[model samples]
Target: MTSVRVAGVGLTPFGDHGDRAGRDLFAEAAAAAIDDAEIDRAAVDQLAYGNFMGALAEQQGHQAPLMAEAAGLDCPATRYEEACASAGVAVKAAVEAIRAGTADLVVAGGMERMNCLDTGEATEALAIAADELYEVRAGMTFPSAYALMAQAYFDRFGGGRADLAHIAVKNHANAVPNEYAQYQREITVDDALDAPPVAEPLHLYDACPITDGASAVVLASEEYVTANDLDAPVEITGVGQGGDRLALQDRDAIAETPAATEAAEVAYADSGITAADIDVAEVHDCFTIAEAMALESLGIADSGEGIVAARDGKTTPDGDCPVNLSGGLKAKGHPVGATGGSQIAELTRLLRGDHPNSEHVADATTGVAHNAGGTVASAVVHVLEVAE
Candidate 1:
């Protein structure tokens, strides 16, 4: 199979875009990506887009063609939705298409608009990602679902809210230098501990904000890169996805995310690298505890030890393996469908030595991006190498 390179990437600042249309956000990101790639839009062979709640948010469906037109692209457009992992899977499809020789130049990304809706409306819309008959009916919102996971972790292991608070402080600090982050200011551990509780053990600072944003990536095959004389240096070497039961009740263990473990296992094997080889990472951190769980599942931290990875300075930017140099979904904002693409875009820039926080990992050669959907029911992992 031919290698796939991240030729270019674009992102709309992750925050509230008042009255902005989803397609409008996507168009800006896509155009920026195309411009960065220095490739004629005419060379694009396909478009893979992701949006989670267009129908509910804007009453607009059949968004693939609409986004393609908005982005000034004329090509076969496809939409992939796996909750918050939407854009990750979209990019994964782009990589597979190029690897299969079905297309060389493809645009993959996602957009999400949540600020347009009231908090209640947006929460209900997002709840559809869970099992409606089971989890949703029981009044289980994401904050609470994640709270259960936190409690499970504390029960099985031994940690408190103080441990999760460290993650919030670390991510917020990281976001200060990230132009695309939602919350770019630092917070103290005491501030996090004292913040209003969203759910027990998870305070306001511990959870990611509901955000509106978009991100896009231009990917090309190695053959296309050489043939077109592109200067792409970051290559997507591995992609893997795994799924678990949709309902939180059906899962065997709430504390452990088997899906992410499975996906990381496959991605690691595919990339011929282990977790120890990962110099940096950007994992889904919709909540502080989620990041801890992700670290464990991805093998960066052993079970029970993941909770304190941030507090121990292990996942800090100056630490052994910095995670979420883009601030992660925690302080970077969670625009649902768009976050996955944003993670990849941030990684591409960091690996390319263009990110504000790249100095932390200046000698890094390999990085990982992990995206997950609803309670870790869906997970997608990608491995990137500095091909330069």
Candidate 2:
């Protein structure tokens, strides 16, 4: 295989896009990324788009072609959907395409226009990822599914609502300065305590908002980067992915994400760096419980101790091994498909010294993006470094 380098990254603001469609949002972000790369659109040999609800939201299928025409690109296109992990999967596809010598330059991105639906309609749309035979029939929503995991973790361990609330406070505080984040204001512990309940243990604050946004990145082969004089490229050092049983009932333990653990093992091995070496991370925080679980799953913290770590300010924006400096999906908004690319864009900015929240992981040279699809059914872990 060959090495891949990220040449440019682009992102749309994370919030409600009143009337913008997925095609429009994606095209705008893709154009910015291509421009940022200082490359011609015609040079792109492939396009990979990440979106979970094109069929539901836009009543549009064949998304890749739609996006291609919108972006005015004539390359072969592929649409990727791994639920919330869509953009991460698209990023992985772009990397693999370059590594396999199938394409030297590829544009990978994600877009979601979720503001079109009301809460009930949105919940129904998201329910498609659940097990129709079991989960959906049981009237379980995403928050309820994750709330089950939270309840199990608390039962097995000793934490409670207070621990989860702390995670909210910290990430909210971190989101204050993130201009692109969905929730940009800081919230107090009382604010968290008073938020409307979404699920028993998960509240409005604990859950990410339905956001509409898009993000894009340009990936090129190492040979292409060198020949084209791509400046300040970030090297894709390691990539790992794993999948698990879709239904939560099939798992032996809700506290553990076996797919995440396996992916982390491969990421650590391939990157030649342990969790200790990672200066910063952008992990999936679709729910506050997932944030704590992710720290453990990534081996950044021991199992059942992620709450303690968060409570102790160990995962604060300026804390050691800061996680989710982009305000995370918690504060940054989970635009379903666009989330993973959003993480990469934030990390890329951090590496380029363009990010204002430099204190999160100052002097950081290594970064990680841990993305998961539908209740840990799929996961992709990536390690990156400042290119040589």
Q: Give the distance in Å from residue 228's predicted Cα in candidate 1 to where it truly belongs.
A: 1.0
Q: For all candidates, what are the clash counts?
A: 0, 0
As a TM-score, model 1 comes out at 0.99
Across residues 128-171, which tens digit of lDDT does each residue of candidate 1 receive? 99999888999999999999999998999999999999999999
Q: Indicate the worst ten consecutive residues by lDDT in candidate 2.
A: 353-362
lDDT tens per residue, model 2, 3-75: 8888888888889999888888988889888888888788899998999987888898889988988887999
lDDT score, residue 221, model 2?
89
Residue pairs clashing in model 2 are none
lDDT of 2 at 332: 82
TM-scores of all models? 0.99, 0.97
Off by over 4 Å in 2: none
lDDT of 1: 0.94
Q: Clashes in candidate 2: how many?
A: 0
